[model samples]
Target: MALASAMAAIAIDTLLPAFEQMRPAFGLSADSTQLSLTLTLFFAGMAVGTLFYGPLADAIGRKPLLFTSLGIYAGAAVVGALAPSLEVLLASRFVWGFAAAGPRTLTQAIVRDRFSGTAMARAMTLIQTVFFLGPILAPILGKGLVALGSWRYTLLFGAVSAGVLALWSLRLPETLAEENRRPLSFATTLAGFRSVIANRTTLGYTLAVTFGFGALFSFLASSELIFVDVYGRPSWFVPYFSTMSAIAAGVSIANNQMLRRVEARPLALSAGVAFTATSGALLAVTAASGGLPRIGVWILLFSLANASMIGFAPVAISLALEPMGALAGTAAAVVGFCSTGLGALLAAITDRAIAGDVMPIGVSYFVYGVLALACQLWARRASKPAHI
Candidate 1:
């Protein structure tokens, strides 16, 4: 599951350093924001593709779908590497994102099959800690690759890595039992979605994760601009970006440790509070400074804010999936769809607004943070007894 999750992150995060090179290679203006579209489009594809893969996983079992998704993802990566134009590359990337939905969505289903409650949350955190390692190291690896060759090599690297991971996945046994499998049908899929929607707690946490993901996506989309354009530290971009992701990785690891003593709900709510507070402070500093703050302050507070939110994912996902034993794939699909789809939307909006100033990104962080907190509170209230 960790490697599966890392596939998507590696595809996007690794290519971040390649953004500068991509524009020129594709005959784009140096200042074009279109390069960022590659990321958003990849996400858009995931949102669509999960709808198919999730239901198929539930119907056919995980192993076959895993092979299918990874094969397509690998092929798409090769196409992206050989793409002769920006249009062709982006189209290939969208397909790459689409095919990736298999691993991205089904991994959660596989985990939910084995565990529930706090243990499930713990598993997710531990997996995510490993998952976060991809982002921490991807840039350094990507930067090295770019230094040695070009951005196309980075895409080719992803192709090769994904193929290897696909083969590695074959060794694992199927988690979804034959008796538990749902027949593939429109009515069955709809019924599963309806069940997810009727559960207020599931719906609430799903939205919380959605908005939370939006904030993170916004930060990621603008990060290159933040470190490279705003701070004028191109070489420092990977180091600082890795530091930010490292904080999230550390928080997930800490959350895994704390899960032995803590429940997921309160911890998630508390994380939301901390995340909102961090973003609020970031907004204040950015407003006072006109736009960019001192690089040191910005990086510290931004990383901290992002870290707080990162801890919430495992908790929220576990809570949402607790009541979804029979429909883990479909449930995960809805959650992934909302989070990735809405997140990509937020990133696109933030990308357009940032222009050259990063104040918009700061504002976006605050806005999404507050929205996530509100959803978290509502979820808590909705989950509680009236007597309490």
Candidate 2:
């Protein structure tokens, strides 16, 4: 389940190290920001895929849909590898992301089908801990592959991984029970969608996750440019990127331990507070430094903020899906769509604002942090018992 969820991360992070090689190969300028479109468009595809995959998973079965999606993912990766132009590559990436969303969304539903409450939180935390390995290792792997050949090698690697995962997933039994299956119809789908939006706690935490994702996405879309171009640390990009991911992964492990004693809601709220604080600090430092803080200080705060945002994710998601019951598939889809689809659009604003400094990243994170915290607080309030 963890490995399947990481497919999207693998597709995205593995390609980051190839940006330098990709520029010259596609006749783009050395400073071109057009490559960021790859990330955004892929996210756009995921957003769209979520609307269909969730309902389909609930209607059909998890295993069949998963297999079909993985097969398409492999094919899309191959097409991306052979793309003759930037437009073709971006188009293929969208298809790849659309296919990847099936696995990503289903992992949540499958887990929900098996566990709930604190157990679900722990399972998700552990899955996320394992999932972070993709981001930590993919950049290094991509760099090695790019060194050996070209960016296309990374795409080919994604194809190979997807094929292997598809085979491995055959071991997974269909978790959705026969009686729990919902009929595929416009009315049923609309009802599922309505249920998700009408639930206060679910909608609130989903939005919290969305804004948190916006902050993370902004960092991702701009990190390479900030490190390689602004700081002139082309060689340090992978190490730094991996280190940030490592911090988030480490925090996830710690969070899993913390969850044994702490309630997921309070813990998630604390993480949101920490996220907002760290983001505010980054913004203050960036503003004081004329939109370019010292690299050491910047990375330190960035890692903390990133870690906090990641820490809030599993628990908040568990909370959002808790009240969902049999609606887990649709609810997970709505969460995935809002967080990835809407979040990517929000991050694009910051991505385009990025030029020669990290100010936009800082500003975007601060704003997103505040919004996420607000949503978390609202969720907590909404989850409380009311008395006359």
Candidate 3:
């Protein structure tokens, strides 16, 4: 499950270090923000693709859907590697993103089938912590491949990786039983969507997760530009980005530990407060310093802020899905759609808002953090108290 989820992270973060190299090769003008679309489009594809897979998985089975989706991803990766034009590359990437959503979202339904309450939250964080290694390692790997030959080699590597995972998924057993399987139909899928949307608390939590993902997507879309272009330290991009991912993974583990004794609500609230303060401070400092902060200052503040925000995901996801076990596939789809789709939109907006400075992106993180906290609070108010 962790490996499957990591596919998206690897696809995006791995290519980040190669953006500058890819720009000229693909005929993009210098300093063009168009490259960021590669990452954002992938998420947009995931957002759209996830809506269909969940109900289909619930109706048919998990294994077959996994096989089909991963196969699409693998084929897309090959097409991406050989893409002759930027249009072809972006289109293939979107298809890859759409395909990758199968394993990524369906795994959540698998987890929900096997666990509940705090156990489910713990499982999620643990899987996420493992999953985060992809980000920590992908940039370095991409950098290495770029060093070896060309950015196309990095794309080829993604192809091989997805192909391997696709075959590996063949051995996994289906978690959804015959008795629990819903008939695959438009009406059944629509009913599941309505069930999730009608629940105010679940909807609020899902939106909160969406905003949190939006903030992270904005950062990912801009990180390479900020470090390489704005800061003039192309060499440090991999290390700095890797360190932030490492911090997120460590925080996930820490969150899992805290969940052993602390309730997710309080821990999540504390994280929200920390994220807002740290990110807001970073924004203010950047503004005062006349655009970008010192590299050390930016890394430290962004890492801390991201760590706080990352810890909230497991808690929020688990809480939102707890009451929707029967609707797990559709619920997970809704969550994936809102978070990835809306998040991608936010990232694209923030990317366009960049004006040769980090101010817009920095301010976005602060604003996103604040809105995320508000959504969490609303979710809390709407739901009844539970042990989680």
Candidate 4:
């Protein structure tokens, strides 16, 4: 699950520092940017893959479905590495995104099948922590490769990671018992989706998770640009970026620990408050300064808020899946797909929209903050009092 979970999702992080190398090679427009092409894989993958992976697991068995997905991902990584033009690269990214659905969603389903309630949340947190850590390391590696090798190494890393994960998954036992497993046919999967979609709280929880990541996606889309383009930080900025990102690790673990004490909903509220206040403060400072906000200050402000994200995201996802106990794989896939896809789409669009000036990012963060706050409110209103 760790390899699978991280394998498909770190595409952008792995390729980020190489944006300049890819930009001219692909002939991307100044405004359109490599950002769109790079981010496309995740959004498209999450959206469609979510719809597909669940039934695939149910029908064939989770192990095979996972293996097949990783196999496809390996092929797509080769294509991305060898892409001759911008259009080809974009197409490859889209395909890669679709292939990613398997690893991301299947991991969730597999986890739920093995555990439930508090243990389920703990497992979810563990998976998230692993996935989160991947991005932390991916960019520095990307930078190192770009310096010593080429952007192709990033894609090669993907292929190798996918291959490694596929081999490992082959060795793991299927947790879904035969008697309990529903044959994951298209019709049956759709019926399961229908049931999930029909539940108001479940549906709302999905939306909450999706919108919550909107801000994070916005940051991912712009991180390289913010450091390199705006702050003029070097390609090695990955280390600095990862340092701030590590703050999320501690907060994530803390959230998981607190699960035994406080409700997920309240944790989410505290996260929302931090996210909004920090984004707003940064936005206001950037605006008042009339230009560049100090890198150190911005990093400190965003890092603190971002750290809490580790806790907030998993809980909401667990909430969405709680109602789909038996269909945990299917539910996790659905929510994973929607949240990531939407976030990617938003990231790409916002990246394109905010290209000329850095100020727009401050605005974008605040806007996303508002939406997140609203979603949290709606999520709370619709749920039973979340148990501490």
Candidate 5:
């Protein structure tokens, strides 16, 4: 599951290395160069598909959806690889994202299907470590491939990877038992969604993770620009961005290792506190200096803020969907939809705001920190009644 999802993620990150080749091939502007990224994320919020995929999983089974979705996703990759125009490529990316949604939503559902308490945490940890490879090695890998040829081959590689994963997933086994399956009816679907919306704890945790991911999108959409255009770093700076991201991966490892001792709530709260405080102070410092802070300081602080988030996202996601065992896909759809959709919106807004300005980037960091802090406090409050 993680391999499949990460294969899809490589479509986003690895291509960063080859975007310039794609730019002319697609005839996109500097602004529109990111249109593929934006559409990929925007399609993430397309919840209409999951409304059916979930109940369909309840009806036919997870294996069919898993394999079928991968097949379609691979098809879309081929479409994207063959695309001759930016419009066509963007459309292909949108379809890829829509198809990829099943794996993203269902994989979490699979975890919810099998375990709870600390066991779920352990499983997510293993999945996350696999996931880390996509972002960690994708750019480096793409760079190697681009050295051999054009960007279209990157999409070709992604298509082939998806094909391999589709074959591999056939063996993961369905975890949702026959008796546990709910009827595939509109009433049941509505009730499942209603339960998710009605539960304050689930809703709160979802919101926190939503903003957390939104902040991630904001960082990613701008990080390359900040480094290449603003910092005047060498062309080799892409590796540095990937490296900072890898260093941040430690927070996930630490969170997973400490899960037995830490409990989800306190770890989430503490990470949120540190995340918001670190980014907020850096923003204030940047503004105080007339929008120019030391480059090293800016990178370190935002990098650290993101590091803090590595600990928060999975825990909050697990807590949110715990109650809706029957609605695992439903809850996951809501969370995944909101998380990626809002993330795209935030990234678009942040991308346009910065439009190549350091001040806007600083302000965005401040805004993201404030939003994350607000969501965390809301989650903290929502948890209070559980203890009562």
Candidate 6:
């Protein structure tokens, strides 16, 4: 499950070091912001794909839909590798992301199938800890590939990984049982969507997760630019990126330990507060330094802020899906769509404003952090039993 969920992260991070190569290949200028479209469009595809996969998984079963998605994912990556034009490459990336969503969403549903409450949260945190390895290693791999040849090699690597995963997944058993399969119909899907929307705890925590994703996505869409273009530290990109991911991964392990003693809700709430504080510190430092903080200071605060958001993800996700019950797949889809789709949109907005300064990233993080905290608070309140 962790490996399947890591596929999207691998796809995204493996290309970060190759942006310079990609821009020239696509006939783009050195400073063109058009490359941001690659990430944003891929996310747009995931949003669309989420809606299709979730309900279908609930109906047909997880294994079949997962296999179908892996096939498409491999094919799309090959297309992306051989794409002759920028338009073609972007389109291929969209399809690749669409296919990637199936595995990513199903992992959550599959885990929910086998566990519940605190156990589910612990399982998710462990999955996420392993998942972070993709981010930790992908940039280095991308740099090595770029050194060997072309940026297209990164895409080819993605294709190969998908093929390997497809082979490995053949041995896995299906988690969804025959008794739990929903009918494949519009009404059934729509009813699931309605249930997700109508539940206060679900909707509130989902939105909170969305805001957290928005902040994280903004950082991701702009990280390479911030390192290479803004700070003129191309050499620092991989190390710093890996370090940030490593910290988040380590925090996930600590959070898993904390879950043994601490309830998921309070830990999640504390994380919200930490996220807000760290982001506010980032904003203050960035603003004080004229949007160009000392690189050490910037990275330190940014890592902490990123860690806080990521560390709480498993708990937040488990909370959102706790009330979902049999609609796990559909509810996971809604959460995935809102977080990836809306989050990507929010990131694009921040990315567009990042010409040579980190102000936009700072502002976006602080604002999103506060909004996420507000949503988390609302969710906590809504989860309380009503007085008779």
How much lDDT does each candidate structure score?
0.87, 0.91, 0.86, 0.73, 0.71, 0.90
- lDDT per residue as tens, model 3, 1-388: 8898888888887798888889999888767889898888899899989998989988987888888888888889889989999999999999989998998889899999998777788899999999889999999999999999999888888778878887787788889999999887888789899999988778888888888888888888988887777888877878888888888899999988988987766777888888889989989888998877787887788788788879888888888888888988889999999999998998788888887678887788888888988988988887764663
Candidate 5 C-alpha lDDT tens digits along 1-388: 6785575567777767776566666566644436536344534534344555666676666888888877877888899888877777777777777777777778888888886645576567667767877888888887778888878887777788888887787678888788878887888878877888888777877777777776777666666666666676647457776786577566667778887675667777787778778777777877887776777777777778777776677877777776667777777777776677776676567667664446776676567767876876775675642220
For candidate 2, the 10 contiguous residues with the lowest summed lDDT are 379-388
Rank by TM-score (best first): 2, 6, 1, 3, 5, 4
Off by over 4 Å in 3: 385-388
Instruction: Give residue 380's error in model 4 in angstroms.
Output: 2.7
lDDT of 1 by residue, 1-388 (tens): 8999889999988899999998889888867788888889899999988888888889999999998999899999999999999888889989998988889898999999999878888999999999989889999888888899898888988889887997898798999999999988899899988998788888999999998999898877878876677677888888887887788888999999998887888888889999999999999998999887887888778888889889888889888888788999999898888989888998788888876667987898999999998887887877742110
Question: lDDT by residue for model 2 over 1-388, one digit each (tens)?
Answer: 9999999999999999999999999999998999999999999999988888999999997899899889889999999999999999999989998998999999999999998776788899999999999999999999999999889999989889988898898788999999999999999999999999999999999999999999899888888988888899888889988988888789989989998887788888899999999999999999999999999999999988999999999999988988887898899999999999999999999999988898998899999999999988888887852111
Query: Which candidate number has the best lDDT?
Result: 2
In model 2, residue pairs whose N, Cα or C atoms come closer than 3 Å (at least 3 residues apart or on different chains), thus clashing, are none
lDDT of 4 by residue, 70-142 (tens): 8888888899889877677777887888888888888888877876655667777767766778777888888
lDDT at 143, model 6: 93
Model 4 pairs in collision: 41-97, 45-97, 45-98, 46-337, 58-184, 59-184, 109-329, 248-307
- Which regions in candidate 1 have their CA more than 4 angstroms from the true location? 384-388
Superposed by TM-score, candidate 2 places the C-alpha of residue 305 at a distance from the truth, in angstroms, of: 0.5
Ranking by lDDT: 2, 6, 1, 3, 4, 5
